[model samples]
Target: MKPRLGVPSDLEAVTSAVIRTMPLDPQWDYRFPYRHQYPADHYKFTRMLFEYFLDPSFDDWLVMVAEDSLAPGDSISVVSFGVFDISYVNKRRHGPGYKPQDPVTEVENRGGKTRRDANHKHFNEFWKGQIRAYKKYFAPLGPEQMHLQILGTLPEFQRRGHASSICRWAMDHVLRKSLKDMSVMASPMGYNLYTVLGFERVGTFYIQVPGEDERLVLQAMMYKPKIWETKTTEDGDGACVML
Candidate 1:
C-alpha cells in the first residue's frame, strides 16, 4: 500500500471517515481523548474548530493517509501534524487581529452560560475552564513550531510499520525547513513508537475523558532536527537548533 499527504480537497472524505471510524466510548478510550457521552453533540462545538476550521486552512498541516486503490478507500492509518507559523500565531495573540472567536468562546458568549442553565453554572464554568486551558497550552508556537497532533493505526493495520513510514514522511515533509522541534501528547500505546522515532521524554499529566477514570497522559517527547540530521551546521554543532 502507498501513503500520501491529504489536502483540504479531501476534507469531506476525511470528516466522513472520522465520524464513521471514531469510537463512541464516552471516555474516548482511543488515540485522542475527549468527552463523547452523547453521540449527537458531546464535542460538537469544538469539532469545527479543530477537525474542520483549523485542519482545513493551516498551511503547514499534514494528514498522512494510507490507501490502496484496488481496495476500500478507508484510511488504514493516519498521522496529523501541523507546523504553526509563530508570527501568525503572535499576531493573533498580541496583535489587534487576535479575535476571540473560537467555537467555545462563541458558545459561551452567545449562550451567556455554558450549561444554559443556572443550577449547572459552577460545573459549566469548571468544565469550560478545563477545555480552555487545554487549548491555551496547545496553541502558542514559534514561527516554525511543529506538533504531531494525532497518530493512530487501525487494529488491523498494527505492526505493519505503517506508522513508522508516516512518521518518517512527516519528519521530512512537515519538519523539513526551519522547524526547530517536533512535539506530541503521547498515548500510552504509542510511547514505544515515539521513542524509537527519536523522541525523548519530557513531562506527563492527567487527562479526564468523560465516563472513564482519568488516564495518565504523557506530554513526553520531542524530536530535534539535529538528531535526524542529513545535514550539518557550519559551527559543527548539530543539536535541535533553535528557530
Candidate 2:
C-alpha cells in the first residue's frame, strides 16, 4: 500500500514525534524557543500548522504518515511522516486540483503579539534568515523542482529504515512529474538520511540568538537522481496516506 495520507487524527502523534526529535534538532528550537515557557501555546500552534498541511484545501502541499503494522499493543501505528511543498504546480501536470503560485514568504508568529512580542522577536529573526537562504538558492521554485520540507520518524523507530519509505515516495513523486531536482534544508541529525537518499549539499545557512548559546544551522541539499527511471523498493508500509 502507498504511504497513508496524513489526517487530523495524525496531528497529535506527528507533533509528539516532532517534539521528541527536537533534542536532536535545532530547527524546532529556532521557531519555538519558548516551548518550555509556553507549552500550551507551542502545542496549540503546532497542531494548527500541521492542520493546515492536512487540509485538502491547501494546494501543492503533501503530508503523509507511515504505520507500524506490527506495533504489538498500544504502540502508535502512525510512526513516521513526511511533509512536502512545491513552489510551482503545473496545471497541465497536476491537473486543475492544485493552486499554481510562486514560492511564498510568510512568518508564523509564535510570539504572542503585544503580550508576547519578546517571545516572537527571535522567531521572526530566525525566519528572516531562513527566507534569505531560500531566496539565495531556490527562490521562485519552478516546475523543475520539488521540496522535501519536513521528514520525521519517532526516535524509537530510527534505524528501522522507516525514513527511506518517505524518501522513495518523494523521489517517485518528483520523477512522475519529471522534475529535475528535490530540495531540502537538512539539519545535522538528518544529514545521514538525506545523504543516503542521494541528496548533496550545495550551501549552508544558520541563525543564532543574541543572548543565548543556541544556534540553528542547516545544509541546503538537492537530490541527484541516480537513474531517470524510478526504482521500486520494499516500502513495508513505512509511509501511507491517511484515509
Candidate 3:
C-alpha cells in the first residue's frame, strides 16, 4: 500500500495504532506507563495529542499513514502511521511552540486524569533532557533536514514492512524536496531498520531524572540522501559516475 498524508478522519485509527505500538518503545512506556490501566483517559489525551498534530491548519508536520483499503471508496484499516516533522524542512522554526495549558501538555504537567496517570514527577526533567539533546546535539545538523518525530505499526501488523514504507517515503521526500538530510529518534525496535535504510547513528542520548536509577536511551540517526555523482570527463565535460 502507498503512503498518503493523513486527514482529520484518520485521527482515530492513527492514534489507535500509535497507542498499540508505542508501548514497545521504552521511552513511550516510561512516560505513559498507565495507558493500559487507564485506557479511557489514556485514549482521551492521546487522541488530543494526535488531533493537535493532524489539525488541517498545522503544517509543521506531515502525518503519513499506510492503510488497507477494504473496498472501492468504502472503508480502510489504518495499519500503521508516522508523524514526520518538517518544521525544519519547511523553514518554520518551532521554539517549543506549545503555549501554557495546552491540553496535551497539561496532561504531562499533572492537570487531569491523563496527567495523574502519567509520569508527573519525572516527565518534566526527562523532557528537559530531550530538549538538551535536541539543542546541543540535533540543532547543529541545521534546519534543512526532516525528522521522523514518531512511527507506529499495530502489534498484529508487525513484519509487514509498513514501517519501512513510511521511512522510505521520508527518504524519497528528502531528495524530492531537495532537503539536505533526514533525521529520526530511533527506538531500539527501529534501529536496525533505519540502519538498513542507510541512516547512520550519529550518537546516543539518555533521559533520566536525577536521583532516579531508571534511564531511557535512544539513538539519533541521520540519513544522507543518495544522488547521482558527477565527475569531469577527459573531454572536460561532466559525466555521471554510476554506482
lDDT of 3: 0.77
Report, for every candidate in turn, its global Cα lDDT versus the true structure. Answer: 0.50, 0.70, 0.77
The sequence of per-residue lDDT tens digits that candidate 2 reaches over residues 1-243 is: 357778776878887766666546766665665677767766666666676677666666778888775556755477788988764575556764645532222114443342221246566667677668877777555456778878888778777777788888888777777777788888888898888887889898877767878777789888845544334448744443322
Sliding window of 10 residues with minimal summed lDDT for model 3: 94-103
What does candidate 3's lDDT look like per residue over 97-196, in tens digits?
5322233464444544335447755566656776677677577866777778788888877778888999999998888777778887777888999999
**Which parts of model 2 are misplaced by more than 4 Å?**
69-76, 90-118, 209-214, 226-243
User: What are the per-model numbers of colliding residue pairs?
Assistant: 2, 8, 0
Stretches of candidate 3 exceeding 4 Å from the true structure: 69-75, 89-114, 229-243
- What value of lDDT does candidate 2 attain over all alpha carbons? 0.70
Q: Between 1 and 3, whose lDDT is larger?
A: 3
Error of 1 at 33 (Å): 10
Models 1 onward score TM values of 0.56, 0.76, 0.83
Ranking by lDDT: 3, 2, 1
Please report how far candidate 3 places residue 81 from its true position, in Å.
Answer: 0.7
Query: Worst ten-residue run, lDDT, model 1?
Result: 79-88
